[model samples]
Target: MSGQLYLGLDLGGTKIAAGVVSGSGKLFSLVRVATPAHGVRSDLRALFDAAQATLAAARIGWPKVKAVGVGVPGAVDPRTETVWAPNLPGWKSVPLRRLLERALGRPVFIEADRNVQAMAEAWLGAGKGASDLIFLTVGTGIGAGIISSGRVVSGSRRVGGAAGWIAVTDRWQPAFARLGSLEAQAAGPTMVRAARLALRTQKRGVLARLARADRKLTGETLVRAARQGDARARRILAEAGEHLGRGVASMVALLNPELVIIGGGLAEAGDWLLAPLRRAAKKWGQPLASRQVRIMRTRLGADIGVLGAARCAMLEMEREKKSNVDFPSNQAG
Candidate 1:
């Protein structure tokens, strides 16, 4: 509290997590709350509540927080400070930065969640030593953050890092057209749907039994079942892994990243996902780039997103200090 303290908020689809982090990448207090499904209003309330709770838990005050950084699951226009989050209904063109500035009484920085995750990894996590890397999150949805020559790549529209739409297959399906080709085939929900479809034809596996018992299937359920020697579950994961690998291969060929760090919920499957992903990447990826790239799971675990947000805050604070610009407090939205 005496020195510079940064507030990091990860506004995920299902949960909003906030953490107070020091300038040296030390996390102080972390808090999480379920994301309200109602709309953007509820989501904003949940985010504010989580941030306030985290600050209180850390024994800090609003004035002490040098800057606040938020990572949202969607496109963010840093220039206009607007957000277009598909998962958050009614979030199209929302002025997230201005609203957070008013609510938190501090300057706020917003970026795509995956980009922040890549920043966190490059700064203090698995991709620490790598100057060029990609952080891919394969969970409820699929996305990628690209870093080249030690810089985050924000394309012309500031949406270049969104790799979920990367085409992994030539065949065009409705889901692919709507949700992005790679995400349509490899995201967590897609995996579950694939498993359900597979069970219809081949009903001989622990997956079928588990689906019958639970009455619903999830990526976690499929991963757990796969670990228990469920053939269908393993097959589904393998297929997803292959699709994911193809996507990674495309990224590598284009970006030539030194490392690729995979995170998010589905990553809990560990080697079950990595092994096949590695195989497919090597098979489909540009040989030179794929051979040079090192693919690994995230070392930061659940804290990656928040930590990434913290990194963004720290960077923003540094920029402000260098430019000698006083960050406005309680700005009007």
Candidate 2:
């Protein structure tokens, strides 16, 4: 059953996506559904529905699916089958793997969402052909994926990519505590926060003029204003780039990765973001590490999560089959 069909589920804060993948990394049928706001049960139901819909659309069934993999945005304990997904509200220590496996009546596995993304990029995206790489997603929060020796690195507990939690600033109050996180300073919401602060100070800047009273501040508008030579917007983005660069510098020092692939909403700023990032990283990232590492934006965009999930499912199925063939069935699981 080598190269058999696979199913993948990507569960996120906004939506859940499911896809049927072939051996060649080609997705046959895909579907998306709004994430359930209530709780884990609601969310799991939606995920299952999306998976089933994709399966039906592909004209396939559970028996034909060799394995299923799910990518979730929280801490996952593969050994215990429990997930500590706080964003899902009531989903803490939920046995997601068992639940999905029983529901699908097939072998199922779960991985941290960011790790899955990192793996896909390392295997098939821009990081392809690199033995050591890092994928830093600079969005609502900053998470990283470490690829070592051409494989995704999972720490003892699979919490390998919690880069946003790293402390960057010292002058912080409880209100300003979030600023310590690289993400809190560089993510899209952070740019909006900067805009609001600029507005309150009545700064003579482009941000005050572009942001309407009723609208929310976002990276897109901030970039637009910066592109048009708005001083406040340019300053905010430059500061964010510096913060992000420092974070990458730290990662490079620790992992010694050959490449750092940046993705997320803020990456749209392109050169405006990269310039300051490079400056700050070089300032703090040390002599050798910063010189050796190359930071580039992700090429896969939004499809990374889905594609990663599919790749994870395929790899797990292959490993499981090899284990079964090498040992008795009772010893494989």
Candidate 3:
């Protein structure tokens, strides 16, 4: 549908966020609801409700809504309009486009969540002017969305930026098959595990003290402990950062992006995590590439995925229009 506002659905494991976005990258009428763990059927209901509430929040109706775009949490095949969203659980080769188009009565575009994040950042966030950039998210698991020459680098199989699979060590474990070496070693859960392990051997660390009665070590605990001048916690994060940097170095050498933007739950560690990452990237990256590229944290905050999904829909619409104009169906052969 051709309309003024675009509907962006950011589907995540825990929540579904719907936002009405203007063409100029202004987001409005954001509505959030819990994602249904039951199944895709229930999740679709939540998605539908979120969309309707978002439009009402912005005081807009469906007639004013443009095409819808969704950012899924796993592999996406734009051509087939199918998604394999692992985070959604039990979603395998789901025909998301057909379902959404039927439910919302609007054209739908789908992309991996990481790719959607890059789209938003490039459109209106940190990578505003850069033609080539890497958007890396280091949360539940590490993933990247790479853009080169103003185009997305979706691989032949649409898994081009699967950064979680980056190998940082020579030792290969079967577990790496699922979580990848870098992720298994440095991702949020792994970081917490490392902190807990540190607490077992060294009882003097602030981290052990910060974990409440349950002694649950979380990323927040690590951050708080590090903030309170806990060397053990800081050291653990820095080590992870260094490992992440090694991965970044490989990306830098291969992609030679102008900017490497980092975002996600773990990124909240700020300079403590990033400082080491920068060092490792520089040290391991090709000298020329490392000298020119700048690594920084994402500035888009929490709404990155939704904004990106909307921007992605806008871009898809533009491309479709161009394709139609170039090969008019009305033209006689």
Candidate 4:
């Protein structure tokens, strides 16, 4: 193995984190920069600059880095190096890999952000010892990554595990007919919306105090109230958990994964979310299938994306090595 370091970039909607990770999984230099909210070009420029700064801070030039791996918040085409990001507008077919490679003068690999997170968990986080696992991030949005047979499972177009968009309801009307979506019901913003609607009613509980603390309700506030034993907050969380559980049930039936790792800002609700979700999964999902899957909170915290990206880079490097040495070479006389 080469004694070179790897650079990992986690380009999220809110922030871009870059770090130099040694082969032994030691992160030497780390830095974070706020992602530009203006548009696609601005965000991409900011991300590339941050990567350059991180490399400089580590005192390691692009020549010393074996590979540059990036995790994006949306789907990426490995063939075209295009990113289809919904949150980031005007990013369709962006030549991200080529752009980064041109700037850093190194091999650049790009993968779905959720896939990177799952890889991180599988390599060094909650799913380390587990062979089959599902990673769920429930925050501004809900998404998933599946690890089966000790490999990350990416469907065609690298958009395999979109758990958030899975339809839960049958009604398909455009306005009040958002029936088949876990994101529509249980994501962070959705939880706040539900809480706000609940507040309009006569239900009185800890949420009232929380709402008073911040006029605009958020998932953090809802979880805080639920933790304080507020009835309204608990009720709101319980309802959302039920919906989330149903989604988990669906996951169990389809994937039969050994473990489900839940993360993101909203997952901090702890048992308030897990308990109800478990009950709901039991009621909706296949009993035998759900029995095999263990749902737990992520232990990786905010570093999962970077770790996952590093893992991805390492994996790609390994593949390149194997292809170079193991494959038979053709020669002409």
Worst 10-residue lDDT window, candidate 2: 324-333
Off by over 4 Å in 1: 198-216, 324-333
lDDT of 3 at 108: 86
On a 0 to 100 scale, what is the lDDT of residue 69 in model 1?
Answer: 90
Q: Residue 322 in model 4: shift from native, Å?
A: 1.3
Taking all chains together, each candidate's TM-score versus the true structure is 0.91, 0.83, 0.88, 0.85
lDDT of 2 at 47: 92
- Give the clash count for each candidate: 0, 0, 0, 4
Question: Candidate 2 lDDT, tens digit per residue, 1-333?
Answer: 345888889887667889888777778888989888599889989999999999999888788888888888777875687987655678788899889988999888788777777777876788877888888877555678777776677677777777776667775646335324676677777788887788787845566566764276666778777888887888888898888888888888888988898876577778788889988888888689889889898898777778778777777776676864421111110
Question: Of the candidates numbered 1 and 4, which has the greater lDDT value?
Answer: 1
- Give per-residue CA lDDT, model 4, range 100-135, as digits (tens): 888788898888787888888877787887778888
- Every model: Cα RMSD to truth: 4.2, 4.6, 4.7, 5.3
Candidate 2, residue 9: the lDDT equals: 90
Model 1, position 111: C-alpha lDDT score: 82
After the best TM-score superposition of candidate 4, give how far the Cα of residue 18 lies from its true spot, in angstroms.
2.1
Best by lDDT: 1
Pairs of residues at least 3 apart in sequence or in different chains that clash in candidate 2: none
Candidate order by decreasing TM-score: 1, 3, 4, 2
lDDT of 2: 0.77
lDDT per residue as tens, model 1, 73-153: 888875687999876678889999999999989989998888889889888888887778889998777888888877787
